[model samples]
Target: MKCALVLCSLSFLYSQICHSANIVAFMPSPFYSHQIAFKPLWLALAKRGHKITLIQPNVIVENNENITHIVLNGTYDILDKYNHVHSLVEGQSVMKVLYAALEAVMEGLEYQLTHPGVQELLKGEKKVDLFFTEFLLTFGFSLGRSLNAPMIGVVSMDTTIEGHMSAGNPTHPVMYPDRDMPYPLPLTLKERMLNTLHWLVDRVMNEIFLNLQDRVASKCLGQQIPLNDIIKNVSLVFINANPLFNVVRPLGPKTVNIGGGVHLMEPQPLPTELQDYLDNARNGVIYFSLGSTISSKHLSNTTKEVILKTFSQLPHDILWKFDEEIVSKPKNMKIMRWTPQQDLLRHKNIKLFITQGGLQSVEEAIFNYVPMIVLPFFGDQHNNAEKMVARGFGLTLDHNKLDVRTFRSAILEVINNPKYRERTKESADLVMDQPMSGLEKAVWWTEYVLRHGQTDHFRNTLSDIPWYQFLLLDVILCFLVITVIVAYVSFKLLQLLKCLAYKLYGKLTRKIKTKIN
Candidate 1:
């Protein structure tokens, strides 16, 4: 009996070990916001006994032996030198913004790929079971291929045309505008044309980036890898989007929506002083922050003055996350370099969230059931703010056009109306109504890829079809040519029949005349 029990125990331990995998999450993108979404997945995977080697600019999740970090300290520094977020506040063209972003990331990622630690990862003969990489950063695909392992692409925003192609999904530029575009749904004919043009431009720019990816990645690994091979290795894509948060569109089987996980699913404990402030507010509280990338203190002098003046007159207590200290502060206002945003939003007395419409921030607002007055500055913020208005949960404002009257009126409009909060709560219900939380689902799918070796079935045929064939231009041309040929033959046949009839009529007339004579 003792021998049989020992054998069963040993077998169970073996099965557990088999399930655990050595995962290399090559998320070298230097954005701090991206880290918020990725941290949960890393920790969850670690809890399951999966060993993770995270190659990022900094260590987000610490104190875990299961997860290791390959910290490249100055990656974001290289990106910041090129990032045009400040220029975007003044309203630049979409093409300019897109190109600037590509340049920033391309340069930043190049710096990361050249790092000694990252190079070691590329050359090391470590046992890698699966690879997780940012879908936008295509270079990681090379590393995945070098290790002969399947790759999962992670998108932290609305899936771009490039991201769609990577996951084998359809791209509907006409029906759905790019995330950066502020056009509301039911686009005009001219708008559709512009959207298509933008789509094509982005596609072309991505190709340029891809060529660089191929060259740089080849140099790093000392192997000649073609772009086609880098593209084919993507086994799955986890897009950080949900039906409620982003426009509902068709997604490939391998592409999964795992949004709302970036924000804290459960509210954290508020600090004593902050908690007292929120609890003591008799009227209400307004929480304001420009998110992580764009600081509130960096606003233009005129814009900042207008905001502060407007806040002084508002009836509710205000909390602003300003990076710098102010000389003259309003009695009802509190300025903190960093406020517990998630926790503050959870307070019952918090009436509104003044924000700069980031994906994670928007999700946080939706999940917390807080209506917002969104002041959009850059990339996807415009569209995200417009969507918030379309849903009746928020209103958008141009930060450049900030006046005391405009800012004051916009805040009052949202607060005075109960419809916004009502709609927001309804949205919260939708965001929360899931079979599994997005985090659980993400971890489940990640392990699913590890367990199942071959998943080529997930790719759609639409992905493999060429652009010309996808539009059915060849079929349409063939049918048009056949129709023209048939029409020409029918016309000639009619002419011949008409001539024969006329000849017969003339002959009959002559025969009748001859008989009469």
Candidate 2:
């Protein structure tokens, strides 16, 4: 009897200590930057004794007993796709380029969905307590329905205009321009009108895409489920943007801004050679990287020559993340295929960051108090660059119109300017002043959802209301109708009064004539 009681106690203790929840995340974007942005959240959860099944195009972290990685092959190469897209959409409107980029992402998602591991998950053999995916690919929400689990969205960049709308966040187009439009806040009348039109176009395009996604997901899931319904049921969203980098807007309770989420951790030590170079730089150093998606080798030869020649003229030593070897590299420039970007930014000697304005890169620059010279290529980079300029911490230049003189001058201006550094430090302080680190907030909210098992209390009811109703068009129409009816009645009453007075005057005139006779 004593042995049996001891065994029962051990069993109960084991159960209590191992109450693990199952979480599945699908991040199929081909960009390493996106993976980096999402890594911290997953790692934190995994460390907390949860079972994670991650479906990604690349394996960012190694799998252990609790973490399972489902690697998807044949994913779209972002650089090749970008090059092809630019060739096809050259001289086209920004909207055209935006649509092309989204299409490329959809293609990647489709490939991921058809993978064997994803198919096995969709089979629903294992119970999933939660599902997480990037927000831009709305079809990924279908996984929630497939597993009958709550869904969470992760935005690698600032929440898109449509994303804000989906989460029932307040979006003033004038105040919060879409990521594609780089106009500063408090826009002019023309800019506001254009921003409004951009929102409308984005809505229409999103509807069309959602329909396509629904159809594709239905085929993949072997059942018909509306994409809108899936989006409406999302329990939470983790947006990788902070208020420091974004306009002031109201977010729904379900929408958690984990801006600087990726920057919460201490950076890894730099390689010995790189550390030596930075340690020995007496005249300060400038770090230039166009990010992972856009390679320096893919740039035009003329552009490359201009950049190199301009860098050679600068007083500061240059560290360029170039993909290939240059035949005649400048003496002051060091080229590497990959660099510990975050680690390098932490160095005191690093003065300025010349970048393509990718969101992650911008956040790193701000977190490290390094001002920027932004040469945007496409998408949110333009908007980020504009914000940097608006915030007085950076300067923007057109990559296509870049000349040696302009490039060199822009660098000098940022380096020579005191205001940029001061503003950058101020912004960095604001970004880091959060009560809790972004990763901690994300994990806490995620666990909150897990513990509650339902987040209907947090969901915004505005998501269910039609756009027309949400905008109060119905109320406006009712007021207009009431005004028109009241105005018509008052006009008729005045006409009737005027006729009665005229008749009275006519009667008085008749009486006066009769009396005179």
Candidate 3:
């Protein structure tokens, strides 16, 4: 009996060691928000005894000594460091800058796909059991397939693939729209038409544009490697969003919701100067950051003058994360190249935030219940800001019309108003109510896919149908033609019966007249 027990214990220990899987986390360069958002997740998995390899350029991984940083060799460091493609392209229109950035990322990613460094990483002897990568990379699907491992797409947006827009089950008012699932109840005619338009636009951008980008990127890899096919073959997708703030629906086994994990980032101590300022500001302080991608130095001199002048007028203290040193400083405004954002937001003295409306900043604001005046700088920033505005949690400001008067008014409105604070509190509550941290849920589902097998059902079924056929307009046209034919036949039969009755009645009338004469 003793000998049998020892053997079983040894077997169990071996199994545990085998289960300690290695996860390869691919971090695409050129976007600070993506890197920052992923930091917590990488750390969490490392702490849990999973080996993680972070792929990026100019990335620093400390504290979690267990995690390995695998910097990919690529020449797109210009896009990553300068970030001019995004922050300086539009001058004022943030979306234009955003679209340009996406285009640049697509272009740079294509270059990286063909780079010998990236190819070597993929073909390396180190066996990565699982893959965790951002959806923006687009080529991650290909990498995942090349490694013969399960791929989990980490989406910053609320749940839904670009192609799955109309599938969301829309509840009353449709607060948070998911890309897949049927709308809860039947929509009215007008609502249906509007939703159809929304679906069309979203599909074109997400499915068509992105899929095309993937193809182009694959071609850059020197031959034909079907990237879309690889994506279609993936096992799971992890969306970083909350159902409370977002619309929830039934998803297949492969997809999981894990959003709030950003808050789990290991908090670092604030610099003494910042801490002292917060202590001095008895009333409250305003936190302003345009995000890392958009440099403050890139803004036009006119706009900078307006912003600086406006800051001079504000009574509350301001902690501005400006990359370049300001020649002139306001009495109340202090500029730092980097601010401990997560730590500052959690501080009680921080009252309001001024941001570029990136998902990371939005998440931080919601996490801390800080009211915002969102100056959306591109991609999904407008959509996120619009949603925040709709929820009454904050205000959206157009960058084209940015001026001291407009910006000052928007700030004062958010700071003075009670509704924005109230809404922000509600958002905070919803974010914190999650049963598991976003990182935990993401890691769990990733492990689940490895334990089980290919979850083919999670893929979008529409991919099977041709683009034109998937629309189904041809079927609708056929049905209309059949209905018209049936109506015409019924009309012709009625006319023929009426003619026969009239002729018979006329003959009877004539015979009666002759008899009377």
The best candidate by lDDT is 2
Residue range with the least summed lDDT across 10 consecutive positions in model 3: 163-172
State, as a TM-score between 0 and 1, how close model 3 is to the true structure: 0.83
Q: Give TM-scores for every candidate, taking all chains together and pairing residue i with residue i.
A: 0.89, 0.90, 0.83
Best-fitting candidate, measured by TM-score?
2
- Enumerate residue pairs that collide in model 3: 164-179, 167-180, 167-181, 168-180, 170-183
Name the candidate, 2 or 3, with the larger lDDT value: 2
Q: What lDDT does each candidate get?
A: 0.80, 0.81, 0.69
- lDDT by residue (408-517, candidate 2, tens digit) is 98899999898999998997897787688888888888887787776888878777777677657899999999999999999999999999999999999999999999
Model 1 worst lDDT window (10 residues): 259-268
Q: Tell me the RMSD of model 2 versus the true structure.
A: 4.4
Model 2 lDDT-worst window of ten: 82-91
Error of 2 at 369 (Å): 1.4
